[model samples]
Target: MPADDFSLRKIAIPAYGPTLLYGLATGAILPVIALSARGLGATVALAALVITLTGVGSLLTNVPATIVTTRFGEKWALVAASAWCALAMVLAASVPVLWVFAVAVFMVGMAGSVFGLARQSYLTEAVPVYFRARALSTLGGVNRIGVFIGPFAAAGAISLFGTAGAYWVGAAAAVGAGILSLQVPDLAVRSPGAGAAVSAPDAGPAPTVRSILRSHARVFRTIGIGVLLIAAVRATRQAVIPLWGQHIGLDPTATALIYGLSGAIDMLIFYPAGKAMDTWGRRSVAVPCMLIMGLGLGLLPLASEATGLLLAALLIGFGNGIGSGIVMTLGADFSPSPGRPQFLGIWRLLADIGTMAGPGILSGVTAAASLSAGIGATAVLGLLGAVVLWTWVPGRKAAVGSITG
Candidate 1:
């Protein structure tokens, strides 16, 4: 296959459709999970815990998910994982008890672990080197599109049918994505002699997960800080932006709109960001992405009104949009083929830790000092991340070439 052809026509064209459906499920239910917990008689604190189970669920099962994906290949694993996610949504819709609902959300998270790792591993191998960045970045954008649209779908469902309707929206997305996943080929397990057709070279012995981790310890030690920082700041943006809007005295409706605007801008830049990373280099995208986010967070305290908040939000969104899949793209670059799934499972675990931590960091910092102080802290973290990317992330590009090349 021509290098650009697969990136432009084959992989992305097929992927965005299912991801949109999956995104609907992902996007729709998160906003309402706490409400659903509330209905189940959860305490205010417990409601937060219930909603958080989704990530907790993922963290619990990611390693097993790696083994499962490695055994079944990306296609079957995704199909099964989506089915599992759908079942969890169904349980969440049907159950009366809050604990059951929490279990359902946790299952959704576990399934997410499987689907995410499988998809990343598949993309790492299926697309050629030159096109890999473009493909992964586009995948990131597609997910955002789902997230961007999911809330509206949830709201409409609630507007018409009430809160349980939101769960149904999630169910449909999981089922639809599963069915669509079936139509995509199992690239990893294709027939013998087919490897050459797809340009898959024979890999050496399949390394144990531990051995792979041990071998790449230095790469992880050196590059992993930048990766962890990126994830933390991105999650920080999602949590901080809304809280800051509310802190500045905007009602929930206006806060939602500000966030919506950010999402729109972030979604718009996925392709271009991916293109630049593929064309320029990883650091080209990574550096500015963090710096812009840091700067945006720093400016949030200055926003006393909607226009000011939106402007800062837009800058952060643009920074995040351009980032697309900096972590995953880099993970793909670092993972050797022999044990890619295992390596990615660990890689994603560390990355997910950042996501889980971001909200807590913001919340704690805000409680300790002030919301302004919290945002300032993230700004400093973002700038520090930029410094790390510049100093530690290894792209000394003369022009648009691979750092590892």
Candidate 2:
């Protein structure tokens, strides 16, 4: 638990490589898939359904995939999941029809959820507890590099070879990730606690869906609610920015630049925020960060000019950098099972719900009322999330003093 015991260099590099590659490939391809659907003559609503279908797949498979890791182990689960994802991407690349592409994307989402859950769980188990927060942050930062690059890559590919070509490249990256998954070292599984005997590797009772659900009730409920609120706010920004930019007569390239700039800022800030979490504690960072994010969301309606937009992006990037790091660290801290995949699945499932709902709510509200109303709604939700943390979660001072004294 000593500060020196957490080796950033030792833990981060190996874990980050595959995750970065995976993020890059997925981020690059997703927009292209949406655009491809649009180009193929799909209606706007149908094009949006691609994202919804992917989310549905992830929601359905996430928990089950986590349980699979509990039974088979994280290493193997990751390897299989990555391979399946690679295959799914390849199949998706070949599909000519929009509906078939949607199905393919759904498969990719299911496989991705499994792979991501296993990898995140592996990090929680492999890294030292004291270093876990920073490690998660480092992972997030590294992964953001992929987010930073992927869309640009996809854009370039779309210009040259079209959306299908972009997907082919994504498929290749996924295969590479699968190969990287094979390199992850297997860690020994420990019993949940003193009273519980470690299950036999072969004959151990697989965690029934019922038990996993019951065991994670409180932690999942709290984190799930928090994540939904956070996701709604974040998703509103994502859904609104492009429309706002276009309404204001910004060129497509300028709009793209804004997104890229925000991503770059997020990548830069995520690591420091992660380290701060390690030193300062989760609540110390998370509550204030969410409040800052709320301020940014509230300010978005005022961002008619480039300068205001850039400032809003900075606030959002830094706030999300801190908020995401804390959430991942907390999920690891609260997980009841050593089988990390299942715990991550539980965490992501709840988080994804918010992500899934955010755009719908934002778009609906914006359609019914003014853009200010939509932005105001997000600001209110962010404030509520911050209040929940301040009131319910323990503070950093208490956490540190307990450990130190």
Among these predictions, the greatest lDDT belongs to 1
Q: Go through the candidates in order and give each one's C-alpha lDDT.
A: 0.80, 0.70
Q: What is the TM-score of each candidate against the true structure?
A: 0.92, 0.89
Predicted model with the maximum TM-score: 1
> Which regions in candidate 1 have their CA more than 4 angstroms from the true location?
1-8, 188-205, 396-405
Report how far residue 253 has shifted in candidate 1, in Å.
Answer: 2.1
* Lowest summed lDDT window (length 10), candidate 2: 192-201
RMSD of 1: 3.2
Expressed as tens digits, the lDDT of each residue in 293-370 for candidate 1 is 999999999999999999999999999999998888888877765577787888888788877887778889989999
Candidate 1 lDDT for residue 296: 93
Model 1's TM-score against the true structure: 0.92
Model 1: residue 369 alpha-carbon error in angstroms: 1.4
Error of 1 at 80 (Å): 1.0
Residue 389's lDDT within candidate 2 is 70
Model 2 lDDT vs. the true structure? 0.70
- The C-alpha stretches of model 2 lying farther than 4 A from their native spots are 1-8, 155-160, 191-209, 338-340, 397-405
